[model samples]
Target: MAFMKEFHDLEIQLEDIRSATNNFGDENIIGIGGFGKVYRGSITHSHSKRQIMAAFKRLDRRYGQGDPEFLKEIMMLSRYKHEHLISLLGFCKDDGEKILVYEYASHGSLDRHLSSTSLTWRQRLNICLAAARGISYLHDPNGTQQRVLHRDIKSSNILLDDNLNA
Candidate 1:
C-alpha cells in the first residue's frame, strides 16, 4: 500500500480503461500469455484530447497470478525506466478486476520477427544488444540500486517499438 504513493500519477480509473479497451473485447486482443490477455487500446488525454495508444493487460481470472504479484510488478516497473523495457503507463484495480496499461509496441514481440527474411545481420545484432543492455540496466548496482533479476527472458517477451530497434 505504501508503494501506491510512489505511482499516484500512474493510477488509472477502471472506467476510463474500460472505455479505452472496449470493455476488454476479444476482438481487441493483441497477445496472450500465462499472466493474461493483452488488448490494443487508445486513451484520450484529458487536456490535449490526443489519443495515446496503449496495451491493456487484463489479468486472467482463471490462470492469472494474485494481486500481490501484480502490485509487485507495477511497483518495480514504475520505479524503473529503460529504452529496451516496455513502458508501464498506468494500472487499474477495481471491482476485483486488475489490469496494466503499457505503451503500445506496434511491432509486437521479437519472436514475431525471427522468421522474417528482412532481418539483416545488423538488425539482429541490434536486437540482441538492446535486450542485453536492458538486462544489464536491471542488474546495474549504482543505477537501479536494486539488483533486479528478470525471470522471463524470452523472444516472446522482448517487445519491439515502431522503429524496430529492439
Candidate 2:
C-alpha cells in the first residue's frame, strides 16, 4: 500500500512538471470550462509530420480531484479509441494544472454552425449524418456485446474539419 501510494504521488508530480513545462499563454487556450481550461497545441510525434489540432485541458490547481479525474478520463478515452471519438494526443500536470490534449477541428464545432441562422437545411442534415456516423463508429458494435451509451452528446463536442464536413 505504501508503494502504491508513493507511485501515485510520483505520477501526480510528473504531471505537474509536464504541465508547467508547456506554455500556458492565453493564446494557447482555446476553450474554458468549469473543471478545466483547454489549450491549442502542436504535437510532433516520432518525426511524423501530421497537422492536427488538439485541446489541452488545464485543471484547476485548487481541486485535488483534478489530476485523478483527468487521468481517469484519459485512460477511459484512450481505451475508447475510435475515428469518431476525438483522440487524446497527450496530457500533463504542472503544479496542479492537469492538461489534456486532443485533435483540433478546423471548422470548429457543431454549435458554431447551429448558432448561425444562415445554414441551409441540407447542410444541417449532412452535418447530422456525419455526426451520427461518427457516433456509430464509436459504438463499436462488433467488439462489445454490451450496448454503449453516450451520456453527454452535445453540439460543441461534434467537430468539423476544414472541408466543412463533420
Candidate 3:
C-alpha cells in the first residue's frame, strides 16, 4: 500500500472499476491470458470528467501472478512511454482485487485479424514496424538507467487501435 502514495494519481477505486465492467460480467470480457480476463468498459475520469473506453486486466491469483508481478507491471508501464505501447490509464487495488486499467484498443489484438483477407500487406508491415519500435524502446528506455526485457511477445499481445496502429 505504500506504492499507492507514490502512484496516487493512478489509483482507481474498485467501485468505479466494478461499475464500469458491470462487475466483471462475462459479456464484457474482450480477451483472456495467463493472468486473467480483460474487460472492455467505459469509465469516467475523476479529474477530466470525461468518459473513455478502457480495458481492465483483473489479476487472478490462481494464474500465478501475485502482488509482486502486479506491482512490477504498474511500475514498468508507468515509467515507460511509447506510441506503440499500450497506455496504462490507472489501476485498482481494493477489497482483495487487483486490476490494471488501460486505454482500449479498438481493433483488438493482432492475432484476431491475422487471417483476415481484407488486411493489406502494407498494413501488416506497418503494424510489425510499430511493434518492433515499441520493443526497441523497451529495451532501451529513454533517460532510464535500466533496460526492460519483455519475455512475452505475440500477436495477441500486440494491440491495434482503430487506425490499425500497433
lDDT of 1 by residue, 22-114 (tens): 888988999988769999989965435689999998898677587887898798887788888788888888888888889899999999999
Model 3, residue 28: C-alpha shift (Å): 0.3
Estimated TM-score per prediction?
A: 0.91, 0.70, 0.95
Candidate 3 residue spans exceeding 4 A from truth: none
Model 1 earns a TM-score of: 0.91
- Tens digit of lDDT per residue, candidate 3, span 90-161? 999899999999989999999999999998999999999999999998888775737888989999999999
Looking at model 3, report the run of 10 residues with the lowest lDDT sum.
139-148
Worst lDDT 10-window in candidate 1: 41-50
- CA shift at 124, candidate 1, in angstroms? 0.8
Q: Candidate 2 — worst ten consecutive residues by lDDT sum?
A: 3-12
How does each model score on lDDT?
Answer: 0.86, 0.62, 0.91
lDDT of 2 at 114: 91
Question: Which residue pairs collide, candidate 3?
Answer: none
Q: Is candidate 1 or candidate 2 better by TM-score?
A: 1
List RMSD in Å for every model shown. 1.9, 5.1, 1.3
